[model samples]
Target: MFKDRTEAGRLLAERLKKYRNDPGIVLAVPRGGVPLAYFVAKELGYPIELILTKKIGHPTNKEYAIGAANLSDYFIIHPGAVSEDYIQQELFVIRTRLKEMYKKFMGNKTPENIAGKTVIIIDDGMATGNTMLGTLNLIRQGQPGKIIIGVPVSSKEAVEMLSKEVNEVVVLLSPEAFYGVGAFYEDFKQISDEEVIFYLSQLQKPS
Candidate 1:
């Protein structure tokens, strides 16, 4: 078990030391991933950017994710599982929120281009990997030279699911009897938008 997201990020950064100073950018899955990604970016001397994406939850059971969507693109793991109307509605709502988040955190700055550059995607943890699968599909459109996923802990299923898609999956723990992401952390707290802004601001400061 890790102490918190900060420690988890530091350890993940240690494993990713070979990529330090490489022509790569860190894409953090907010708002939980920001803190962890901040530490990793600091350790690797890379710029940090937010990869804004949210899961498209099933209509019947909102907790179950059928796919994921960003502002421009989306991925559906189970195409016929949900209705077209539902997907469209979810996409609109999710994109609207993502736009607000992007504006809030980045102000008027444009997103970084990842073409021909190594892209390291960081998150607190993965559960079913459905959401991440959706994220990967969108990231692929950017034509990155290589894609890597860094997480502190994940379920065995999540690791297996993501391993086949990305160039590499760096994980600290993949327990067979997997529990939710927060269960492994002693100080797991919901990250607020204010905290997200703070971390991003810190990343922008001169070293």
Candidate 2:
């Protein structure tokens, strides 16, 4: 496992320095993504901001993501995991929770203004690929000139799936025996909504 998220980000940023002066923006999938994106943004000289989205949890187990939501008021439900009837039944609840989470986690951030820009979506890592997929659908709405998915590490399947979703996918590792995203990181603390907002508000302050 990597020493920590920062170290992993440093390694990933090296691979992304080609975009240092290129026309691009970094959209982080918080709250874990915030840290990784922060370091990468600093390295590559790009603006970083949170891309708001939420997991559409299973009807019975909220921990399990059946799909996810995008900022355009759209949800990406996993076609293989749940039936159409089941997803249709839970659509309303999913949308409601997603909006609530957007407000709670994203604060006053606006996801617009990315029209025709090259947007790079950053996450600490990917496990199921649902989160990255959901966030990608949202980013695609802005009609970016280019779209890239950057992660420190990911499962082989996640990397493969994400590769098809964006113009470019940059991952440090695609371990075959990956059990989860945290498996690749030594420090995998649970990031809270408050922590996400705090980092944004604190780091953005004028020096």
Candidate 3:
């Protein structure tokens, strides 16, 4: 279908060009979102930063995220990911790891910077959307003026669910036969920490 994630990101950037001169920031979910959000940030002229969070995977299946956790003083946990018993047991470990991530990436900065500002949250795509939902909930407490969730492609269910959560939602494709986020792209390799560091370093924030 599409040549690769870069081309798809360019196309998605074109659609979001109107935000270039507007007051906004593109908060990207790291790893996969960096490439797509990098292009969008380059085109949109908004600074891009990682919305750091972790998937609270099932007790056994680590890859399968039953819920998600966003740590920055306060953490938003998803209920469906596990039961209360599991959460009570696992919260400390997740928090400790997240703090380590915060120190390594964000340098223990306060997460209140996005307050009262327009935030454009970008991701490569959305599937179950529980992760993003927790993201929204976590940031909403910071009192952003408006939240716009953007993605290049998503399933019908994800699009529908996300639309009701944010002020504006942009989705480029919602194929009925959606299998998974990786299926649409030719290169779905995991994005490395070095790449994330490189892009964030290169992005120039308007003063």
Give the top-scoring candidate (TM-score): 1
Give lDDT tens digits, candidate 2, residues 97-206: 66787778656666547777778888888887876776677667778888988898888888888888788899888887988888887889987877777766654667
> Which tens-of-lDDT digit does each residue in 87-111 have in candidate 1?
9999999999999999999999888
Report how far off residue 137 is in candidate 1 (Å): 0.5
**Which structure is stronger by lDDT: 1 or 3?**
1
Worst lDDT 10-window in candidate 1: 15-24
Best model number under lDDT? 1
User: Candidate 3, residues 1-207: lDDT per residue as tens digits?
Assistant: 455678777888888887777777888887788788888888988777778767666788766666566654334354455567777566667778777766765665555377777788888889988778767777887788889888888988988888898887888888999988888888887888777777776774444
**So what's the TM-score on candidate 3?**
0.84
Q: What is the lDDT of residue 72 in candidate 1?
A: 87
Better of 2 and 3 by TM-score: 3
Off by over 4 Å in 1: none
Question: Model 3: which ten-residue window has the lowest total lDDT?
Answer: 72-81
